[model samples]
Target: MIAIGGSAGSLPVLAELLEQLPASIDCTMMIIVHRLKNVPSDLDRLLSLKAPIIEPEDKQPVLSHRIYLAPQNYHLLIEDEGTFALDYAEPLHYSRPSIDVSFASVAEVYGPRALAILLSGASKDGAAGMQRIIAAGGTGFVQDPASALFDTMPLAALELCPEAQAMSLTDMVHFLTELKMSAEHDQ
Candidate 1:
């Protein structure tokens, strides 16, 4: 699995990443972006231009090669059984669909094979989760602070996970494009 989390300045980053990604990749991509509880995911619709995707619901079975968007008001968790479990627990970082919750689950589920990326945000929501990913032997990356409109989130993640690659928008796009190609080639 490839898990990504972002907040304040995340929409454009997510869109650009999606646009560069191949129509199909070998693994699932799950995104948790901080959003208001009642707001519907218009971003999900916008991103469908690139690949098959869904705003996951409770008990939904996870599918490889799909993009899953975390819903508002609920923290999306990856169950050990390869299903999704939505939680309404108190928000971490003052937001539901907490990035840390989602990323940590991905780390636990996929371990060394997981790839976790933290993008632009206003808070440190994903920092600890990035730490968890690295500690679990998964690869970690963060958007370059210079490329982020709001640098705090990425900066925080860099501090916690110093081994994470700091990627600019263009660098990240190129990396993921090549990664998908390599994974497909290996398969």
Candidate 2:
């Protein structure tokens, strides 16, 4: 499993990452992006050009090669057996669809099988989440602050977990693609 977290300046970075990644890449991808209150979002439409996309329903099973977006006004959690659990909980760090909530959940659920990516954002929302990913024995990737449109989030993540890999969007895509290929071969 892969959990990617971002906010504020995420759109272009996410789009570039998606565009560079192959659609057939294995592993389930769960994305948590901050959105406005009760706003109806169609993340699938925004991302479908790059890969199969889904707006996760409660208890929806997460599948490989498909990207799942946390729905608006809810926290998305990863469950055992690669399923999702959505909740209407109050916001964390002043944001609903919190990256920390999602990353921590995936960390608990998949442990070393997971990879967490922290991208461009204005605040520190995902710092603790990326730490959880590392603590759970999962690989953690943070976009290099130098390359990010907004650097605070990535910088915070780097501060929280010094071991987290820092890469440009292109390098991150290459790393994930290589990881997918290596996992396939191992399987």
Clashes of each: 0, 0
**Residue 114 in candidate 1, Cα distance off native in Å:** 0.8
Question: For model 2, what is the error of residue 97's alpha carbon versus the real structure, in angstroms, after optimal superposition?
Answer: 0.3
Worst 10 residues of 2 by lDDT: 35-44
| lDDT scores of the candidates, listed in order | 0.89, 0.87
Candidate 1 C-alpha error for residue 107, in Å: 0.7
State the lDDT of candidate 2 residue by residue for 1-187, as single tens digits.
8889888888889988888887688778888888887666777688777776788899888777778888888899988777889988888988888999999998898889889999999989989988988998999988899888899999999999998989988899889889978988999
For this target, which candidate reaches the highest lDDT against the unseen true structure?
1
Which candidate wins on TM-score?
1
Residue 36, candidate 2: C-alpha displacement in angstroms: 1.2
Q: Any idea what lDDT model 1 has?
A: 0.89
Q: With candidate 2 superimposed using the best TM-score fit, by how many Å does residue 34's alpha carbon deviate from the native?
A: 0.8
